[model samples]
Target: MEMFLYYIHLFARNVKRTPLFFALVILTLSIGIGTLLANLSMLSLMSTDPIPGKSEQIFNVNMNTYAGANNRFGSMHVLRYSDAKAILDSKVANNATMHYSSMVYSRRADSQDLTRYASPTRATTASFFEVMGAQFAHGEPWKNEHSNNIVIGHELNVKLFGGANSVGEKLELQGKIYTIVGVLKPWEMRPLFYHASEGKAFDKTDDIFVPIEVAIDNNWAVFARTMSTDSYTTLDQTRQINAYYIQVFVELLDDKQHLAFQTFIDGYANQLKEKGNHRHEVDNRLYNVNEWLDKNEVVNKDLLAFTIATGLFLLVCIFNANSLMLSRYQASQFEANLRRAVGASKKQVFFQGVVESIILGIICALLSFVLAFSLLALYRQLFDELAPVAELPLHMLVIGLGVALTSSLLSTVYPLIQGTRTSLASILK
Candidate 1:
């Protein structure tokens, strides 16, 4: 108990002597620690799955062909509704979902004038909702049995129907009156992979979804195409669906099954190509759940690399602080000599130094947490374009506290040791 009181006195005396230097050390350490904690929080939030279902089993398949004039690089393609149907019916995939895109016109129920929007008017199978892990806000997704039913996003629902429950409500698209079956909850929009690669954003915020069979029955040219009669084309009737653009997705049970399925798809595409049905080339670029997360939700490679570099830089700062502390203790040789001459024991003098170091560490830790929170908020505000507010996670608070405590202890270690080693006799000489 007496020892603790002595240490406290020592700490108070040291602070009185060098208040400004102590403040500077703590500020530099806090900034470095705060930046690291913020980045770790951003990385964690973006890469984790929002849904807890079996996302690992899901995968996306694109139609592709390797035939351009260069022939060195293959051109990717999307499947038509007919080709997608053949793959689904043959049970080549354990389960499959398909969707195609088109532009459509829409308007508010009260408004007479039509407003044209470049929406992804997708024709999809019933399983698409299940495959993509989408949740319906009010009613169920459009049923395959209901030909004229459609599901619209929450944003679209608000724009077209004033945000009312629009189940069984009517809306017009491309001269056809369709019944609204469901509305989707607001979600972070992502560009489709193929389109994203082409520098286009697949903004599904205003999208409308319908059943694939219904689209074909209505002879939607966006879902399928027929060749002109005047052309002397000798392509097989089965291969007539060259111009249709559709994306196919599959779900598998395990990695072994996934590889087997991928191989089969490759061979199947090869057979089609050999038979002169090769307008679009097929390539084997499949994504498991982890890969999908990395592509869509995780931080970009440049950001990740930059974060690591900054973390290393902070470590360097901590080391530099250690060196500075050691130098300060060594420069206090006259103080050590006076304490020794005043009959202070070697153990008493060393314990006093350790106590002062501990006090400084505690002060720095408290300041670091405050600084970290402020810096994190500023970081989100400044980089809102690259890192959204949604990227911040609650766990960052815990992580920041830990970083602050750890950094303080580490920075104080060298100073504490150097202070303890100062000899009263050597200092007096």
Candidate 2:
């Protein structure tokens, strides 16, 4: 420990003598480390399991009932309303929830301020809260499925009620009065598995949630894609039509339940085939949360390619630092040889170099954080849709430090060897 501190003191004096060289090394390495760290942080967020423990159990339902082309992959992730309702009514799974996205103009019902904000809404069933593991801060999910009662997200609550518990308060949506039965706590689900398709995976959670039936009754317009041969003017008309819009997710506890649900889905498809409602072959599938995300391609391929490029850039930076350190060490050969002539072993010289590299690593790591933050900010500006995931979480911070230290040590290896191997007789003369 004493020797390490002594080496550190020597390193400080060396830096004082040639601060510009060290500064250049640190800047070069920080740029590479910071860029890599920024990319990694976003990638980590993009690929992380939105639901950790139950990700394997919660499944997204898909039925290849598309009339256009039955064998087309990824064409049937969304389901028709009837299909979603049938699956929910079957009671085959441990829990099930179905929803369709919508948009509405909302305001406090009794507020004298007539201004209304455009709100993203989820027209879902009562089980959505439980199935999605949403945390409630004030009240609970409404008991009545078709009632005017609704739920508000924390952000919406803050906007409407100043973050107070506003349960049982009245809210106006598109001029229709609805009671708030629940207010959610601050929660974010990355790669939002429920609606991962249609390029909406990284979007924020809906500001409001209402029962699907009530939404239909009130004619809340569907905010997502709806495909049908028949023309549908309202959400109610979507119920009986062949329009494919709603997304369904169900929780099955075990493989047995999963198989059972699959069997049931097959039987249901067969029934449709018998009734001539479905002309396509039965190709029903159940994708767990991660599988669903993969099917939807939630992780951007372009970002992945960019990450690889950043890794290569980091390598270039490492080599550049190595060259800089080589030059610095070559210039210090006189100092190294003088120590060797005065009884300092080659091993001791190498150890001193190692300690100096470690100090440089520590400084590089601290500076890298600032550079990484700046790069992340730039990424957020360029990729507005990915702004939510462009953050340095705790694990990514640790990884940055580890990478910086490893790079520093690696860059110093050949330099240290060459410095320690130099002849001492000339310096002693």
Candidate 3:
């Protein structure tokens, strides 16, 4: 520790002598490290499993159901309402659910005001809450009354029912009276891993979660996919075999369940093929949370490109740091000669140089963290794609420190080696 403190003191003195040069080196390092960290933060946020415990169990379902070899919907990422319903009906997995995004207006039943706001909704099943680990702050999910009962989120509860429990309270949605059966706790799933394909991955939690049957019966309009074989006069027509617009997911744990689910998918596709209605190739896919995000590219591609660029910039910064350190070490040749003459060994000089590099790394890391925050904010502002992104966690300080120390050590190897290996007699002359 005493040796380390002495090295630190020497490092500080060197920096005090060449303040601007050291400052520039630190700034260059900060820019490189900060940019890299920002992109890493985004990648981490988008790729994290939203449902950690259930990610392995739950799988997103995809099938090529479109007829004809050149159909646009062939090899797409959605299923027909009938296909999704069939998968759920097969019960091949432990639990399963499908949902589609919709907008519905809601108002307090007792309110005399004619005002209402369009609520973003999830027309899902009771199993959805279980599959997604959605916590309930109030009542439980409805048992018998699926259509007439609704689940409201925390913000919606505050807006409609004054932040009360709101269980059993009457709320009117799309001109139909429904009882609030449950109120969700504050829920946020970044990249909305389950619904990434629908373009609502970063959207706010749904204000309403209604039964799929209720959503279908009430004719809730869908904003996601709607591929059709023919024009539909009624909303029910879209729910037919020809129209494909539902997102399905199943929870298959053991190999038995997986095999069963896979068989179900293949058998269903074969049935359609045998019936002469299916023309496209049979392509059924199942992806977990991380796989789903990867398949859908939830992480912004530009951010990934930026990551690679920042890595190269960091390499350049390291080279620059190495060059600057070479100059600094060369400037201390007189000191090195004097110390070597006073019986300091080459090993001691090398250790001192390494300690100085570590000190530089420490300073660089501290500066980079502050710069990273600013850079991240600025980057998010400049790129609209990064809007509504999650921020880096406080624990990223450890990562920054590791990066800085590793960078400094790597940058200093050649310069320090040459500086420490000087001939004492030649230098004394």
Pairs with steric clashes in candidate 1: 63-77, 64-281, 64-282, 65-280, 65-281, 65-282, 66-281
Show where candidate 1 strays beyond 4 Å: 1-17, 37-42, 49-53, 66-69, 72-77, 100-107, 110-123, 154-164, 172-176, 185-208, 212-241, 279-285, 292-299, 327-391, 420-429
Give the worst 10-residue stretch by lDDT in candidate 1. Answer: 223-232
lDDT of 3 by residue, 251-340 (tens): 998778888889988999889889875678788888887788887888878788878998899999988888887887788788987887
lDDT of each: 0.63, 0.90, 0.82
List all candidate RMSDs to the true structure. Answer: 6.5, 2.0, 2.8
Cα TM-score per model = 0.68, 0.94, 0.89
Q: Candidate 2, residues 277-360: lDDT per residue as tens digits?
A: 776888888999999999888888888999999999999999999999999998988888888888889999999999999889
What is the overall TM-score of model 1 with all chains considered together? 0.68
lDDT of 1: 0.63
Q: Rank the candidates by TM-score, best first.
A: 2, 3, 1
Model 3, residue 113: distance off in Å is 6.4
